[model samples]
Target: SGVSCEFEENPCDSEPCLNGGECKGSQEFLHCECSTGYTGERCETKIDSCEPMPCYILGTESCEGESLSYHCKCLPGWEGNGIY
Candidate 1:
């Protein structure tokens, strides 16, 4: 007679994520939650939240992304346009 035990493998061992992304184990794959300034399926790309430079408002307001939404922030020594 003989007995055996099965051991589950750790999914994070291969480290599929990139750019300091936090890896979460799912059933068949990993779920990567990107850190600040990064976004993608594996967090392998850098986030460009400040694109197009929405500084048209007298060159004051700057556009940046907060999570999935964008917002305007006044530059140094600048004031808000009251539209935020």
Candidate 2:
């Protein structure tokens, strides 16, 4: 006689990973691989590069921050890329 077994549900079926995180594993367990600029157990936290403020003269108000880098806004009368 052949034996029959019940099917097991995958833990990742619910898609627990958040914020562009990739889920890996199977019915046993799952983990999240967060994308750039994001961190935390579920990738919910966005890394702020401007916390320390790298801009000089113009201060943090004119500081443009990204995931891993920052740019300073040009002073008044200055032209080119600082307008944005």
Candidate 3:
């Protein structure tokens, strides 16, 4: 009897990785290595750094963490950018 070999398709060929994420593994296994400030299976989500609130002043500063960068802003009636 003769043996036959089957060809497997690479998952990365579809360009599964997003947001500059790197695709890894073979047909048996596939995953996305997301870049900075990115998450999810296909790296489709942008991590929010302000979610935990990095501002030093409680209720006095506004934290804006969009993707890879973060900034703190003082609320009204307050002074300084709150970056320190």
Candidate 4:
């Protein structure tokens, strides 16, 4: 007969990585590394890692960049709103 340990160990408690980051061990001490766009001990934070791009209206020529997006340029003469 053998005794089984009922309590499981917290994987993150170990010094898994040398960079002082949380570890997710499978084969190695630290399997997955967190990106700069993510935070938290488990990297639960999500960040926008992409730069804003310019948006142009279907028929227009005007264009602008936004925080996470861009504006559209209106077409030649027909215009109601820059965005359709």
Error of 3 at 41 (Å): 1.4
Off by over 4 Å in 2: 1-5, 52-62, 73-84
Model 2 RMSD in Å is 5.4
Show the colliding residue pairs in model 3: none
Per-residue C-alpha lDDT of model 4 across residues 21-40, encoded as one tens digit per residue = 45677422445366555555
- Report lDDT (Cα) of residue 73, candidate 4: 61
TM-score of 3: 0.71
> How many residue pairs collide in each prediction?
0, 0, 0, 6
Residue 17 lDDT in candidate 2 = 81
Error of 3 at 4 (Å): 7.0
**Local distance difference test, per candidate?**
0.68, 0.72, 0.81, 0.49
Query: How many angstroms is residue 84 displaced in model 3 relative to the true structure, after the best TM-score fit?
Result: 6.3
Q: Lowest lDDT 10-mer window, candidate 4?
A: 48-57
Of candidates 4 and 3, the better by TM-score: 3
> Model 1 off-target regions past 4 Å?
1-5, 57-84
Model 1 TM-score? 0.52
Q: Which residue pairs in candidate 2 have backbone atoms (N, alpha carbon, C) closer than 3 angstroms, thus clashing?
A: none
* Reference-based TM-score of each model: 0.52, 0.60, 0.71, 0.26
lDDT by residue for model 1 (1-84), tens: 124546556677778789889899954777988888788898977765546554456745557665445667766776655243
Ranking by lDDT: 3, 2, 1, 4
How far out, in Å, is residue 66 in model 3?
Answer: 3.8
* TM-score for predicted model 2 compared with the true structure: 0.60
Which prediction has the highest lDDT against the true structure? 3
Candidate 3 at residue 83, lDDT?
Answer: 51
